[model samples]
Target: MISIQRSQHSPIGLQLGPSSATLVQLAGSRQNRVVHAIAQEQFELDEKQSIEERDANIAAQIRQILSDHHFKGRHVISCLGSQELFIQNVRLPQLPVDEIAKVVAWEAEERLPYPLAEAELRHLPAGQVRQESNTKQEVILLACHTGILKRHLDLLEQAGLTAVAIDVEPSATLRCFHNSSNDVQTNATNCYLNFGDAATTVIFADQQNVLFLKYIMQGSNHLDHAVAENLDLPLKEAIRLRKIVTNSPTLDASDELHRSVIDSIRSILETISTEVENCLRYYKVTFRGKKLDQLIVTGNESSPWLIEFLSDRLSTECKMGNPFESLKCWPTSTSILERPGRWTTAMGLAMKEKSNS
Candidate 1:
């Protein structure tokens, strides 16, 4: 199981995705808090490096970055994408936190695809579920394997950075919204779609109720490849062009290469629509009373046009997710906080500290 003696407060948050790594540091005080965000320099593993070598290098680079920034000895919370872990909404007889382990083990036999011993297990009590016909009450259980976690922690330890909390990226993303949105819409059905490097995570929750979750294997890399193929350029050059186009309207959005990129985006939209609809359908069947109210998009791979396209296709009102947008910050930190949507996971990891307080 993922070991935790007691949760330690971490001011620095590291969100490592397949494509890029984001670092967020808490700056200033309680009265005038701000975030020092860095997204430009990311650790990219060499394809030629072995798994052990790559993990070591990732840790080393992270440490070097911290040293260079003069951010030594700061507690750091590392995060993992949903694709790397397994999560199931298991229904079990309601019991105290300490007693849930045996139940988790019993459920793991049926729920987990691998051997029970091969994975580490963890669970959170998601309230009680009382059945009308029977007197027995059940609670939601969340389980995660240890093997998946060690891979991430091993890398961090190798890097010379102290890992405080390891978080699920989707949970972290949703936590960002939960912290930002007031109780006015507390019970409303909300969905957060995080477009990470290797995959996309869709989280649908209603206040304390988590209804749907899915990770799709689609991502922005397809667009990169499409641009490269059509432009007859290397992948790196294509990525450069893609960013240039996004930042400036100088290039023709209708050019042959750009059209290919657009097509790739459309494909992503199709999958998102299908997956979201499936979730909505399941939610409707299970939770007949609640209705979905909003959809938010985040992650470095997300694009405004993608949201617009999906909104039109799904006929659901969509908005950019900027968890830090409404939060108070210092004047000098305004520029860094401009793109708040991209920092959802990091902000959420940092918010864990706030929750403990």
Candidate 2:
């Protein structure tokens, strides 16, 4: 959602995480787009650093990335990292568009873990739903704690960037495919799963418009944790084993170590799959509009093993998604985007049209 004056130009799309940043800029008309600039850098998060210090360091990193690339313009759009915001679809009596916000505030106070006064609340009217005999409005309610939201804007200002819009992960993730999904049948429902370092986002959409989304608390990092606990190894050591097994195409159940690693990873992935199943079930039961047509999965850790596991668990046509498929780019940009999953969120943010709503 937008919070400030909309930019007149195509601003940079910046995606920030706990330990890294990915920024993408695109130019040209909708029919002939090109990747203007793209880059990603990772940094170690030191627990000893205070929040202010941490943000400053991140801001410095953003500045460096900007200077080292061909990114133009200072206006940008951004998103809260994984688990940074709370999202839920709440039901209310049909109300005027201008009256939704006040009612949404009451709903937020009742549902949020934090107080109402401390939140930056926003709501979108997502059509009407049947509640027994009565029809109720379904509003997509979003709230990011004020402290976290302020910190996000602060970092943008520190890096000499103007924030035109600050979006959430699920919305940003869905927007990634907006430009390229026109040819698909709009009547059919589709799903988008975005895996990040700390969380995975599931978005259901039709013709690039989001129907609903779910933010799973688990991410790729959970794989490491599961392996460490299962194998009784140090966190770092477990990561070593996980890196090998997760991406390995050879999942020979006959091999001892491979079986052990796969089992360990499966324990956590199963839990994630269960969550996704529940999400899909909820969507079908609540919306009851259309059957799932496809599932597009993307992430930095979206390895063959992980994709295969998810596809087998989920009953749909699951495949990797490339957001830059329609964009022209040089080898330098292509090299960094070799694994397109990680760039989905950033590209989604950049793809957003300037809005006054």
Candidate 3:
């Protein structure tokens, strides 16, 4: 656990995930940075565990990760992933900055699934949109259950960490590749596809800021389960075999087992591809954004085959997203570089400066 070293130091990034806890600490200034991130499987809880038991188990897991890594800084910026969030892209008539929140609350009345009173709501400006001759401001309305947020904070408290801010995973992901489209900012846009465990996040942005965001409920886990069912293997074994097939660029088509695994996951692959198409089409038609220059892929389960499938479907170039740019790293942190994409959210959280928000 890295200790906060006055104002000049970056706060640690602590991502409290359902199955894993990722912690990252960034050292140095904006241009020159060094980062070390660790992702540890947290304690698995059964339904029988009481709330107190669950908290203690989870807190211990968080502490174990910190102790094993010896990362300093208890002050951290954390995030709420898709499962705990409800987000919508809505268009609103222009209004004074002071009155925007009120309008968002009103607009959310017809959109949010839950009563507005029971939710913690926040709105972010997603730039302007024009339809026919009318112009409206596009906003991303975000909501999380009040109790869910309380539990999040409670976990942080139990783990002896200070929450400088709470961020949504999409925001953290956007922060990781904000500058990805800068080179082609004037003519083309960049798409970020963060293939998470339970959901795949889609963000359309260019150079400086995020223009749109959406989530697909189906994620890499679906594919794993599909393979598991087909091979009659346990999930752990299925995941290992699937990863081996995906990581191997020269996977043998003649290998009967590998071929069967690929065949099993075809449906989920098609579903993800369709979702990507819908997101891209919506962004183009609504935002009137430029052509997509490239797709920036991330997440632990992302594969070379998935990238190829997407790239071919959209007729756009694709590549793995890289957030590490001028950062010095310790010799022992090679794993961070090896699977950097999986730690993108934590890295982005580490980059976020301290704020009450």
Candidate 4:
């Protein structure tokens, strides 16, 4: 929970995700060039209902959260993951920005499996490319079913929150990273692994360009379940232990508990590494970019040694991301600053809303 005072007075931005909502109350002072951001309470939801059912439940949950905090400012921005949005990067004749909508529509109709009428689309120019035949250019068109976008918007409105902008999660994640790190501004290529409860999302970006986005079935909870089964412990206990133990710190000599947990996670990481490597190879040949500089692990329960283990196995630098950057961390209350990496998506959403406002 970092507090910031910026140079300009901007309306507060609220970010809502599937599982949680993170709010940042902001104010700015011009003379000081400071951005004042106060992190509000985080509200977690079940978020496991069927898509249709999830919306109503989430709406209620959000309303209650706002009531609890007595929050009224409604300018909000939400994010949809790559899974929810269909994105395609295509090369086209260098055209004016006004012509891009029609061109992108034509390309989407030709490229996407879904019908153009069924999809709600938007496009952004990536950059110009030099081809042997001509100087071609590319644009990344982001599309999603109108129904899907509507559902998210409806949910927020039902929650009594104003939804101002809908952004892609990959873009939000990358923006959050760039805002936090000066190193990434130098055009370094890196992979961001977002481990959720049931799934892991990997977004690879070169500087500002998003190269690959995917969702993996495996995640931290999968490792917890494996450990629970192997140790014959309750699910709750297994979860508690999972956050504490790593390859270096095995449980005990008599019990193979430590080995079991490490082995389970190692296997999962290996499978993910293979998939990542294949994606990297494709980008390397297609785009002719630098090799992957490192991998950043982020999630609620990211263990320190798990980062070490994966770094060793993948032969890449594995560092935990800091979700609490560009803000002032409260000294008296340490809970918000603790485990900040896991809040990357939520924090990114909050940051995006602030920027957009």
Clashes of each: 4, 0, 7, 12
* TM-score, every prediction: 0.82, 0.85, 0.88, 0.74
What's the lDDT for all of these models?
A: 0.65, 0.77, 0.76, 0.63
TM-score of 4: 0.74
Candidate 3 residue-wise lDDT, 195-312, digit = tens: 7777889888765466788889877678788999998998888887887787755557899877988899878878887888899888888877466788888876555666777778
TM-score of 2: 0.85
The digit string of per-residue lDDT tens for model 4 on 1-357 reads 998854343333444544445554334331222224434343333446576677777677767766665544666666765456777778889888788899889999988768899998887665555567577676777889887778778887887777767776566566667744334543678888776655677767776576656667676567778878877888678866766564233245355656666665667777867776676565565555457787887765455665766677667788877655544442234655555665566556556534341
Over 1-357, each residue of candidate 2 has an lDDT whose tens digit, in order, gives 978964333689888877668888887765666777788877556679998888888888789899899688888999887578888888899888888998999889899999999999887666666778888887888888999888889989999999989987767766656546444445667788888878888888765556676778787678777888988998778877766775566577787878888788776678878999998887787676568888888876665666677888987678777777645543354456555777888888887775522
The predicted structure with the larger lDDT, 1 or 3, is 3
Q: After superposing candidate 2 on the true structure, give the runs of residues whose Cα lies further than 4 Å from its correct spot.
A: 1-9, 179-184, 228-261, 328-337
Off by over 4 Å in 3: 1-9, 40-52, 179-188, 326-334, 355-357
* Number of the top-ranking candidate, with TM-score as the measure: 3
User: Arrange candidates by lDDT, highest first: which order?
Assistant: 2, 3, 1, 4
Error of 1 at 161 (Å): 1.1
